[model samples]
Target: MTDTTSVFENSPEAEFGDYVALLKPRVMSLVVFTALTGLLVAPVSVHPLVGFAAILFIALGGGASGALNMWWDADIDRIMRRTRNRPIPAGKVSEGEALGFGLALSGISVVMLGLAANWFAGAFLAFTIFFYVVVYTMWLKRSTPQNIVIGGAAGAFPPMIGWAVATGGISVESVLMFMLIFMWTPPHFWALALFMKSDYAEADVPMLTVTHGRKATRTHILVYTLLLAPFALALAATSIGGPVYLAASLVLNAMFIAGALRIRRRDEAAAEADGYRVEKRFFGFSLSYLFLHFVALLAEAGLAQFGWGGW
Candidate 1:
């Protein structure tokens, strides 16, 4: 369905690093971390080796999705400044090679995850790959401005998959973790879209800024941030939450809300004058914010073994 025909180039064979680049390492890191957190926080216990294998395969599944995304979006990647240097877009990797690589990894990750962990986790990984490539990439991505809004589910699934790996099931706690990521995705991405200039435009991607303009994007960011705060706090009420998580969420949410209000009140004139520092800082803080929440959750789980997680 993607118009990738004209985007081909004749170049040297791709290097090993090129294959790795195809995996979208940055995105994979988030998947690995969140997935690890999910496995760690689950009430059930898993052997260290089994848990490691599960996370590794889940990371591979995430990487496979990224590789296929690069393959499909090669045309647009060539146009977007941020993505122009990616292996597929740069001619370092052929589209067919990337496609084959993605498919192989997809099969291996899912089948092995099923064997190494549980069928549900493995099946979830398969559905995740399908949703990302078939639903988000081929369908929602170019078709709607709400693409990331729905597509966020692809990333949110890692934590749920991790939980499934541990417990072989889903629960309110795991769903809360999924919701935490789901609610955070929009504002997190919209911030990047805000200061990213015209990369989306040149690629013909209907990013919020490309569709609704910066004003609406800013407002949406604030609204999502406001909503995300309470959802995150709600996790503190679950079995996993503790005094530490509660304290961290309270302070973090206050700071996050303040940051969102600052961005909401910002105007184009002030943004240009300041190089969009506020938005950029908000973006950076968002990354830290997410990492710390998981870290707090992990801390609670760790301490809970000593009976300190709950109030």
Candidate 2:
């Protein structure tokens, strides 16, 4: 048998914060927000305590996925300037500890969600964890230029899981929410890749910018931004949609497309000369773009209580 001593060797003593870093808190926040939006916008109502518990469990599950991703990607993380300080990469947590923490949380979160909500929602969460850890992190991230394109589905599932928490099933509204994130992910990550310099290339991750060239990646960002518009607009016609969402969708999509157009038109010389200002600005706007769209959905949901919301 192979000697496994190094695999389980203890690293430096880890702090509470280091362990938390293993959870990728920023990504978990997005998961929580989108999931909460899905639950709130659903036609069915959940008791406050149950809704709270469901969201908590869902957030835990998302964190579990993040931990597992960190465990698996520890090597890549060490090589990338953007990720070198992560728990495992920084020697603050052992791979074994991260793997164990992730697995324990995964089990607890799935079981608690099932008890708090419905079994279907629990199963969906389980599948999401599996997809992110096994499918996206393990399989796609290193192998293909289309990793973010296909792997984006794993991130897109949170809102649907949230919708299921209330309705205990799927619907057009939940699906549109899923599509909105799914379509937006490629352009969002691609823009980051555009400005990230050689992180992906040095790490040997097959990002579009690494394998296909920046020009192709720029074209892709434009294409995805254009494709994303329809889904965002279509959600405005759903039961959960209203004037607020429609107006937000129109303006955000217009601005997003304009950003993508500017990105596509720029060559490397121009981008490098300006320090990738356009790409960086586009990336920052993409975060606000998603957040504002969801906030508009929440606003519409609130307005519906006063009979001023949906069409």
Indicate which candidate wins on lDDT.
Answer: 2
TM-score to native of every candidate shown: 0.96, 0.96
Candidate 2, 9: how far from true, in Å?
A: 15
Q: lDDT by residue for model 1 over 136-178, one digit each (tens)?
A: 9999999899998999999999999999999999999899999
Q: What is the C-alpha lDDT profile of model 2 across 1-311, one tens digit per residue?
A: 13455554643779999988888899999999999999999999999999999999999999999999999999999999999999998999999999999999999999999999999999999999999999999999999999999899999999999999999999999999999999999999999999995898899999999889999999999999999999999999999998889999999999999999999999999999999999999999999999999999999999999999999
| Candidate 1: stretches off by over 4 Å | 1-11
Candidate 1: which pairs clash? none
- Candidate 2 residue 94 Cα shift, in angstroms, is 0.6
Residue 104, candidate 2: C-alpha displacement in angstroms: 0.6
True lDDT of residue 32, candidate 1: 98
Roughly what TM-score does model 1 have, to 2 decimal places?
0.96
